[model samples]
Target: MHATPAPPALDLPAIQALAAADMAAVDALIRRRLASDVVLVNQVAEHLVAAGGKRLRPMLLLLAARALGHRGPDAHQLAAVVEFIHTATLLHDDVVDESDLRRGRKTANALFGNAASVLVGDFLYSRSFQLMVELDRLPVMRILADTTNAIAEGEVLQLLHVRNPDTDEPAYLKVIERKTAVLFAAATRLGALLAGAGEATQQRLHDYGLALGYAFQIADDVLDYSADEAALGKHLGDDLAEGKATLPLIHAMLHSDAATRDRLRAIVEAGEVEAMPEVLAAIEATGGLAYSRRRADDYADAAERALDGLDDNNAVAALRGLARYAVRRDR
Candidate 1:
């Protein structure tokens, strides 16, 4: 019986530095392909791109490719394709969520209206497919096409759960698996595919991405309850206002007394933003945040374990750091 060795210390800046060159290329490609003759399309697409998120998904692709010994222009094109697909989803997501802010800036839908945002999102999607066609790889095309379909299914699945207090952990996990984890899997798997890695290695990378996505989304749910609004880049109770029954709230409800459970249910069902104080109190009392954090830690550990057989290198090290950072990030 041997204990699993601990992962190395997480250094996010170091990880970013390692991927900095590749990411710059991806960014440039994204900007170049984002241009459209229609002024509104350009405005909406540029708005989201300029907001400047961590670009973690495409970075995952680049890092995975490097870990598998690939340094080619094809990775850059595919990385940009991943970004465009991700950005398109975000655009549509804001419209569906009716969100006003993202990354501390007004959402595209907020600035340009839902119609413009949706149409531009379509443009990005089509552009991504065009880039994929240029790559001339059927496998790449299949993976992304399937991933986008799964994301659409995830959106509808989440819509069904929204404002429904009956949503449980299993159902929530299903939503995240499709909405988030599948794309993460696609990104890393594509990395492996591009590098001509074996089936086993590709499977490992896919598993790593899947687990990381779970950890990241779970940690994000916890942050919605406990993180500073400024650092979180959104209102504290945005999930609650969206009537989303995320892990913390679900956990709190499961462990609370009938009265408290009913209160939580009402809050979720009614999108009761004002009930955040009470919800936080219940979560604290029930150790819901602690429970959710523990779940995130488990998934992060799985992500690290999935990388065990990969050759040790700067890229692999960064992947490990990313897994830890997924659960530990402030925003």
Candidate 2:
């Protein structure tokens, strides 16, 4: 009879609240995990950790656990473990992407070089494994192991898709699922798992994570077309320059007439994003960016749907809000 309250705006206050909720335990775990015999381990770990990461993966874990009425300490430890996995991926990603700037700071690979970044990513991965073993959770271990493997596979898949403008939705989804979705799924699943949620609830958490991850990544691709360099922390149309056939580009090429399509192909194949204005105009004309945003909205809707059975609470509502924020964020 009455409408349920929508989640609050993901403004600074809310983001800060989420950060505060996650800060203490994840920070401690990072410090504990970064310790090593080699000095470069400490240096590389500190550089990336101190480089002002958003820590979204950990926030999702902690909040999802809180949403499910979990107050136990294990959630925090697992949340930190999720972040370590994410950070490791990021370090490796910078090297693979061969770019500079993350969150407005010089990329770890750019500052420290590829070898340091790659080796430190290995350190982070090993540290995460050690922490998971400490948790003594077979399910958790299985989830992460599968997730990291999926990520690695996704990276290669994306590289394969690069410079090829024919990448369609299915191809794009496969790349994002491995490169992004599994980690999100694993993090939220860990929360539900730690909460001792029923099988149904655990599945819902996985669904939410998967959908949210798709929304998050599709939005990022849209940002590459629309975002300003200063705010987005990367060059506009970087995906195009890198020959990444994300949804917008893939969709545009799929729908374009042969001449227009050829022009688009040349842009991607050329590997010169200096023509971003032209690319942006073409994508906008074909409504590719709008189409991408709409698909992201679809995934966000699915994410909210997965929360249908969660107990009525602010945290639950916040989780729904997060689904929207993933698509709506400008930066």
Candidate 3:
């Protein structure tokens, strides 16, 4: 008897190819909706959209919608809305972090000035709300409203933890849930809602998005220390310079000797860029990076498991591929 054929490998290109047409539509919608009468707002918003990253969040919404057999224009509109919300967060985050660089280029706050960036971020947030209101779906409006509020709370929570070396893993996870995972969960859950999916299916997709968000952010924190500056598309040690005690640093502190722990804590409190070499050595010696990678992989696995009972389709396969990519990507 012939052996059972293996399932096809769904690499990044394959996944992107599968979602290309839908993404193109989403992009078009985004551009049209981003237009404003104010030129500065237009310039800043255009600059941000042009310096594009992977567009993963919107793609997640699109893929989830397609997975549930949704082919309507509502998916496109909602995807654009998700992109606007995410873009707004980035603008605000750069200002809050005092970051000069993102995606290997000057941040909007750096180029357009902080006030412009902040105001334009508000524009995007308000624009996104407008788009959602146009949808006239109460559930969609409610989910996004709650998600944005949680994100704001997360910013405050992270601000509190900044420069506090005592910030532990649980505290960090709470920040990640609000700042990153809530939006992700909103995207997928909205897709399911638009598709008229059952409540159980919606919850599973929400679980998938949340796990993927955790995996993505944890891996990003790892990359901030381990990846080359070009590959990472931002300054190495930015997190250190921001005084944010991410998982690696927390793990290193937990596992290291008293003297080393004290040194790490002191460096974090000071936001000392000059102490990076010492910090790297401590992280390596304590297996901090490895431990963090293991945690990211666990979350990725959880993301995949959340899709266990879903229909086997290209979109579902792409979702699985994204979970794998979330942990494996360099940037």
What does candidate 3's lDDT look like per residue over 234-298, in tens digits?
99999999999999999999999999999999999999989999999999999999999999999
Candidate-wise lDDT, in order: 0.91, 0.84, 0.93
Model 1, 1-331: lDDT tens digits are 9965544644899988989999999898889988888988887777777799999999999999999999778999999998888888899998999999888899998888999988988998999999999999998999999999999999999999999999999999999999898889899999999999999999999999999999999999999898988998988888899999999999988999999999888888899999889999999999999999999999999998999988778888889999999999899
Please tell me which model should have the higher lDDT, number 1 or number 2.
1
| Quality of model 1 by C-alpha lDDT | 0.91
- Give TM per candidate: 0.97, 0.95, 0.97
TM-score of 2: 0.95
Among all windows of 10 consecutive residues in model 2, the one with the lowest summed lDDT is 7-16
Error of 2 at 223 (Å): 0.5
What is the C-alpha RMSD, rounded to one decimal, of candidate 2?
A: 1.7
Residue pairs of candidate 2 with colliding backbone atoms:
none
Candidate 3 accuracy as lDDT: 0.93
- Kindly give the number of clashing pairs for every candidate: 0, 0, 0
User: Which stretches of candidate 1 lie above 4 Å from their native place?
Assistant: 1-10
Residue ranges of candidate 3 with Cα displaced over 4 Å = 1-9
Q: How many pairs of residues in model 2 come into backbone collision?
A: 0
